[model samples]
Target: MNAEPTTPTTRATDEHLLSIDALAAWIGVSPHTVRKWVTRGPATGLVPRMLRINGQIRFRPDDVRVWLDTKEIQ
Candidate 1:
């Protein structure tokens, strides 16, 4: 069976880029914490995988999902 091919529009819609507040809400943290996570160093091991777009910070939903998966403690 042939699956429907994905389009740019569909992919763009599916990959939501979140704001600091939105990401914080999704992860149960405060906006300040999220800001710290993004701005802090590698030592924290809590830096978010984000993009700097036009001087604004943006976080892809997929990146956040992957980060969360990596953080799972055994």
Candidate 2:
């Protein structure tokens, strides 16, 4: 079995809207790293569409799933 974050998994609607901190927790990385990835572009070709609310970055849960599915093989 693949140990990658991209491995197929089920998503709960409640966990869909992932903040940068939430995303980092899911991916086992630091929030800073997640922010860097969001800015520098994902290791894969998928880029998260960021929303600025009160000057804070947020990511949609569905979008993250799509991004994971579309990741390019290294």
Candidate number achieving the greatest TM-score relative to the actual structure: 1
Residue 37, model 2: lDDT of 72
lDDT of 1: 0.81
- Clash counts for all predictions: 0, 1
TM-score of 2: 0.60
Lowest lDDT 10-residue stretch of candidate 2: 41-50
TM-score of each: 0.73, 0.60
lDDT of every model, 2 decimals: 0.81, 0.72
Q: In candidate 1, what residue range of length 10 has the lowest lDDT sum?
A: 6-15
Residue clash pairs of candidate 2: 16-61
lDDT per residue as tens, model 2, 1-74: 97777744874466545689988887677888887777776554535666677877788877777777766587
